[model samples]
Target: MLENIRENSQGLVAKIILGFIILTFAVAGIGSYTNSVDTSVAEVNGEKISQAEFEKAYQTQRARMAQQFGEMFETLSNDANYMAQMRDSVVENLVNQLLVDQASRDMAIRISDERIKQTIREMPAFQVEGQFDNNRYLARINQEGFYQSSDFRDYLRVEMTRRQLTQALVSSEFALPYQTSLLTTLQNQKRDIRFATISAKQFEQGVEVTEAEINDYYLANPGRFENQEKVKVNYIALDVNDLAKDIEVNDSDLESYYQQNIVNYRQPEQRRIAHILIEFGDDKATAKTKIADIQTRLNNGEDFGELANALSDDTFSGENGGDLEWFEAGINGEAFDQAVTALTDVNAVTDIVESESGFHLIKLTEFKAEQVKTLADVKEEIAIAVSTQKAQDKFFELQQQAAQLSFEFPDSLEDAANAVGVEVKTSAWLSRFGNAAPFDNAKVIDAAFSDLVLNERLNSDIIEVSDSLVLVVRLNEYQAANTKPLEQVSEQIKTILVQQKSAEKAQLLADELLATHKAGDDISAQLTANNASFEEKAAVARYGSDLDASIVREAFKLPHPVADAVVATTVKLNNGDIALIEVTAVSQGDEQAPASFEQQYSQQLAQAAYQSYVEALREQAEISKRENITSTSQL
Candidate 1:
């Protein structure tokens, strides 16, 4: 093959192939060759949304859902359909963000850096006692997954710009007076209605399921009585909180830990300085020459602030006399720190310093001297840290031993529990789709019902239920899937058949009454004469009805009474009974919709319009998505 290719390379055919290859590289670059596999969850207009980006976005979305749904989050997450929706939501959000960024760029929507900084400064989370706190701002952004202030600034700019676009679309939407009027008329429409309830219980008394009928239905639906394969699990749980309770820290331990970690307790010397930076752009000689000229000016008693404002490459600090703010050693690099630390007096200037960032001319404005604390000041904090460290070390040892024992002795978890000095706990009956308490988590459930544990009858390897909780399980009792005896479910079958027949009888009576009313005979009189109560409700709104909610919904679903004639219909009630609902009159509210309601409704319509706008943009945009990567083997 090599010889053939080599000989062909001199021919016209090979030359044509080589030309195409070169052109491909010219268009796509060498990255196209290196990245043999595409790892993007989605792509919009050739911009790839990498899998890592999707995972991060998914985590953020999951956290939001956890916060929003609270106790329901766990159950919802376990629901395959809901989780699929959640994954879809994450992908949609990523795609929408890319779309927004692309559209924003095309439309020239850009927020100023100063505006970004101002937005951060004004955030309530970053404020301390009604004032912006720099430390608080930094800590808050760090918690939000942006460790760098600049990164946070960029994030805020994008988010703010997105909000601006959304507001633009919303503000442009308007609901006309006629639109509001029509909406209010429909929303405030009232129906004067009456209903006659014919209870299923009246028919149920006469409907009976014989033994033969029960047997026949039970035989027909055999799978309905089949129980889910379940296991009663006896397992051992190890929790960090329980282990830490017995581990004690003495005064000697605290003294030793405090001394070993003394640097953490001491405050580093902070230096406040201003500097003019000229990056190594275009040519090293040009940058060097610029820095040297700045140094000469500084040496000749020239204004450093004015020079920085005019010549510094860092525009952010340049605008403020190149103030780099307060920072400690090792923060501004070793070379820069050496110059700042060597300054003896305030207003001391250093010669041009060369660092990885580029050339810098440092000017010292002020400094805060380092402070060391005695053992008494941070005694409590030290004690806690030392104690936690010791507990963690012991916990780690037990964690390893328990996992090893569970795996080595796969038949039982007792040995592992005893070795770790943890209690062996047991769980009530648990099936593939259901469990209780600690075992209720999806990960633990998956591990419990695994082939190794459920089929092979082996102990589970250590499962991390949470960061602090670990578990190893073995099947105590297993019940294979089996159908219940006919005798056991006979009563259940009877009740079902009885309900079916009773409901049919109820519907038949309702249909007959409805037919008579439609044929011009009053059925309400006959119902009342037969000892059936006619429940009459007047001026019933969409809500706040005394009738069954389902009936109210059905009544509202009914058309308005026409030409001074009553409208009647038959609807199946939720309780398996049937009701004859009659609407005598229908009326709309005389008053106009309130300002607040009109505003809210208009905003709702605007939101719907904005969504349509986004959909339209999506229709025009070229989008490719990978669905298989959305699921995890074990969530």
Candidate 2:
């Protein structure tokens, strides 16, 4: 009976038994009612971390990882430590999700169906032309293997609730001003210095090497000497675009589509306006006074364009007399747009409007009223849209025909092609692992390597390369692997020897230069005579430009720069030039910062603190996980 219970524990019968036992005890205080209920794997909190749920989550994670890494998945699975790490990661993620669900229940954080709908409507993926596309949304959901919209919506709701809980926890944490200021200062501080480089190329002209040494090096590295095999293949590719070009759209179709979707052809109302913007200074009262003075000037008949040219801080627009040039509604902030749109007359000046940028006085120059476009105006667009639809439908028909052909003549490519009214084409000699011509599809390559093609002269099954077309291929011939003689690689070996000798000579010269500089000997004349230039860098902070940041970090660790004392630094340039640098100076910058900058810095620190707090919470949430159960297991 115990063995049977263990085997059937994942079935619906076991769930019914467990449910019956709980209900029987609750109603009548029944004791020892069920001998078949296996509850040993249940959690201390009375929540069943069902074997099925664990296996599903585990398999999902495994498949995701395998898809991401491909062939490397096998290598990763072979390692015990890697498997353990993956298991732990999956378990942690499952536990966090469970904890989020518990927290949502405890806090009564309800996500409404309407909110989920609104969220989906707002999502850019589901939107077409700035509005939610119901067909596109449904099609995308269907493609993801969900049978119903309600199921997908429920998943989205759970995710949204989890996100809200995380946001709440983060918002509750506070960061201090002092911490913000320190971080801001660190972020903004810049470093300034002077340095010179000694390159390997400068000393490489004198280096010499023998053939015996090169031959010995090559002998020691046989694997590196092996050449990779390459092959050329011939194939007829069937791409969707190819079929789309051949598909035609008539005038009637275009006109019909344009009439059906008229809203898509209408343009929004737009306005052309100019403005005189006055930004607030440090003090609000003083800034307001300055703004009032600007308003008085505008009222007293001062040219708005001339005033904007003089006072506007927006460099891009200021040059053109604050002309923002044909802005549509909602392009600018709501306040600015409302103020601009309120002006009925072309010469009318707007009253002072306040925004984050500052107070703004505007003038309406010109406005283009919205127009519902005629069929002629959008003929080209309509034609393209209609053509695309026709092409898709034709492609679907072709796929059906090809599928039929494949069914009738499963063993012959020629017979299938004859049935579909298309010519049969043969591919050039291709190896099992060779790249498929034009289309590097794994499916095509796998078809080429199937037992029928590799060992027997059997035609490949119809392989759908893409949405538009299917391919049926038969292997023609095969090529055996070949190795090149050692004599063929002798020239390559000679070039390698030359580069090695050059690099060694350059290193020796760089070492001597460093020693000479350390001994307080002036080498600037020698450096200048060799056509080398000195680069002066300033205020390069830790997270500055990549090159300067790397150099600065290394230079600061060295002793203070002194006259004739060069701190030699070797860096590899992207152009294959090896640079050996001499550090001339290094100095720390001032650490004073503004209050706003400090606040921004503190926000970043708070985010990091919140992440650490969440990780701690997840660790404290005790979770036990089971694995390898069948789909029949119930929660």
Candidate 3:
């Protein structure tokens, strides 16, 4: 279990720290400080992990995990083993971070202030309406309990510097030509074969099993027969939907609401506009002179479409002579949009409008006027609103009646249902964690497991399942743990035996098909006669775009196509079918593949080499730090 946990470090760590932090901050959140504290727990060279620093770092990790998991924290917090695993991860992460920080200082790695600001401005979290918002940035920092912007900036700078150093150390490593060629050779391969599977249903019809064998299997697996805890509850429910149906919407109020929100009933006029654009940067004066020349040509009655096609900097619309499709107000830049909207008629041309995208000479090709919808046109919408309100009112009325009955009777769900004019619903017997029927809701299951309902046999309190439904329940009776009799489980055991035999038969048939193909017997005719399709995938790369890379990798390892060295492979599908493959052809290409495909494979190989280098560096650094820490503590 620990080995599996180690393999999934990120998932395990996230689960462990799901809820602990209400008051601590992680080192990543800490601002810069020049002074070292004496209460350091461990040091990487002269750098210290002070007790205060550790507490802060721990708290930040806790808060981050809590936010990510939200309400699921209860499930994680209840697991003691998971929590312990998370603590170990936190310590390891902190130690590695300290080492990396110290190494950056020793190597004199520094990140520029401009780079730090640029990174912060690009962060998606600090953006408001698609652009960086200063107020949002400050609010986020304040929410995280940071006092100053410079403090957060300095921390980010150090982390960035450390990352740069790691990248620099690892980037030079590359895979050898021999390794690359071997990988490519293994990718370009194909499989061809004919096969059939003997399904379990085919053999299950006539299969027989003795009663004694079923009894023996049941006796050996007593844990499977143990009765799970169950519950019943008696309660009252308040359904909002029922109440909403009885509520009324007055005609005057509907008219008033419509008048107040009249804008919703009207559609704004839109215009189709296009423009010849000239962009300006540092050479603003030169760009202005060029734009003026184009305007002069246009004033002289030169063809706008011809001039735009030849002179426009907007490539996206230039090919169509600067013809942009229809757009509503606020769709384009404010200055450009305002100028276009001001045009009084279709085919109107406006003076050059300056915007962030540069200067644009606008042409309005078409226009649409606003159209307002009448009250009669939206009657169905009003009807729905009225019905929803009435249903909510009725639901609450039912809840009040049921609540009164529960109070009066104090013992029966039936009495409460009778008082509310609703039917009493009883659920089938269900295990505590089993999804047996409608009673499978987690909240309902938790309520069913409560001591009062499960053991005391008392009526459950009214519980809200959703806004529209409420339920009261009670445990009727519980079955105790006992081994199921042989007669009860005989059919299940027989089915299992049939499936096992079917799988073995399928494997045998697949093996024979491969053997026949290897012996130079053509199976294409047999496959075609059986209505099985044959596909030929040529020049398949190791990192195949369409097929699974793992499948392609295995396929390429077979002997050359001419040799007919068939390699049998079986793919275990999620749906219980074994996809048997027999390799028929294999080939290797010398050149790097196309740019789009080659780049992805190159990056994968490069990253793997880089990660291996970083791990080696980290291991050596850790060993040296451990020795030094031990010596200092002894002293």
Candidate 4:
């Protein structure tokens, strides 16, 4: 079960820990916590949520975010709104869990130990070859840090019991047939429309931005005219490839390494054997009697090959006169191997021996003694491998020393570089998105900008660029973010202003065309006179991946029109053009399920109902926090 939990429930383990922590919240009142605990963070009913538990959950969440966001973790961690939302979510999760526990007690929900054991046994992680293995279950549980099986089972019991209650609350809720049909209809609805675009570029000849407009726009949007902050850095790196070139291996060292790892080059002893078996299954006595009769034939000097071919119950080997070709130990069963090895005389049959396979008679045909390669034969290969291993070891050792030296003398990388025997390399100016060799690592960039490294100008903590490399950097020069001068950005701002004016003119003309077209005027002719053509799209749906998506979206939003009536709508396209669309016909989709829509709708309805059920429980529960506990304030 523990193996299964580790394999499939890595994420669920954190959730289970959260559930356990929440279950610790008060059983009765705050007074009980006041007398019984000083380290509790919150109290619900009379149970306590410990400070340690809250810190664990909070730290786990932070670490998870750090892994997911990398350098972005620093920005998100400093966000006040994000932190507050995270804290509230954690607190509400605890509250909801406590309420569920309370509900479970009120409803007297229970799970039996036998059921839990069966569940554990059935878990894939605990099974070997699809059957439960007790040793694997025990080893996995201990490896996962669950020392006591009872506690692990109890933890699972809570989850199982809660799931049962959750299913009971939500499983009955399902979408009605009419509701399902309506959803399917809307999802597959199609509209026939005609659309024409008024390109923004068409107005470019007439639209112009003056110097005053450019100045006004630049002043209004100062953020768009800012220069990026840049920094140059000095760094020392330890890479295995660089170290490997300097590594040298002597013949003595190669021979020593090979001698110590000789087992890897030695082949195991092997034996070739022929055997016959009568398997004991439903009728053990009958199988034993049959094997005894076969052994009597061996004693009577009957040909073993003929006897095996006619009488041996082992099918595959029986056809070939029971010839089990060369195999090493661990291949055949222990009992069979022991019996076969005991027969020292060549081609001599052994007495009937009982094994897991029932009864067997065996003869050894050929044997191969274990052999090892000579030092001369593998010396060159060993030397190269030995050199590589030594180099990798030296790289890691030097990296560690460099990391320590940088911290002990944070002002410069000189001492650290000399200690690691590498030169301090300087980089060109780097921005947040710079991709120069080692600076391509986000960790290196983030550390270079860190407060201690950037502002205080100290050596960075060792940044692991890859498995084979580690880097330590210090800022050499800093360029604070500043705004570009008005003169320098004037032309860029002018182009933006001109484009904005052009798009506005296009939208205005398109709107005028739409108004005139809706009032029975020939807008297509008017657009043709204005150097634009009306394009027709047939049977476009609300959710299609095509060029007419924008027009189709706007057309569907308009109310359905009567026979001979056209519905006019205008939509803005991504290319900064305005599309004037006219819907001529509307069609409802057939009332039929699309694949597994029924099952999907049922699941969504059940989940929504379950969410509501949980919310209702939370609303009714009495919850409190320990005033003295502040360490877990974020949680």
What are the lDDT figures for the candidates, one per model?
0.82, 0.65, 0.63, 0.79
Candidate 4, residue 480: lDDT: 84
lDDT per residue as tens, model 2, 404-434: 6655655565555555456766665554354
The candidate that achieves the highest TM-score relative to the unseen native structure: 1
TM-score of 2: 0.51
Off by over 4 Å in 4: 1-48, 78-81, 143-145, 234-236, 245-251, 254-385, 396-429, 433-437, 440-443, 450-467, 472-478, 625-635
- Deviation from native of the Cα of residue 564 in model 3, angstroms: 9.4
Error of 4 at 1 (Å): 78
In candidate 3, which residue ranges exceed 4 Å CA deviation?
1-73, 122-133, 166-185, 194-212, 221-236, 248-410, 414-423, 427-441, 462-471, 476-483, 498-584, 587-596, 606-610, 622-635
Two-way lDDT contest, 3 vs 4, winner: 4
Query: Candidate 1, residues 293-399: lDDT per residue as tens digits?
Result: 88888888889999989998655566678776674555446898899889867888888888655788888888888899889999988888987888778878899
Expressed as tens digits, the lDDT of each residue in 1-635 for candidate 3 is: 99987667568566567433422444424533534445555565456665566556666666788799864665785676666555555555667777667767877888987788789879999886787655456456656654345557867887798789767755555556666656554444334432232232343455555667667766777666555554443344556665564567778756765677678878878787777878775577777887788989988988778878898865436656777666544434588778987997987788878865567788888798989888778766765665675676677777777766665665577888877766666666667655654466666767677676777666666666777787777767666556666667667776665666555554555566557766778766654553343455655665544754444554555444454355556554343434445555545455453445444566677678756754664676633222212112113
TM-score of each: 0.77, 0.51, 0.55, 0.68
lDDT of model number 2: 0.65
State model 3's lDDT: 0.63
Scored by lDDT, the top model is: 1
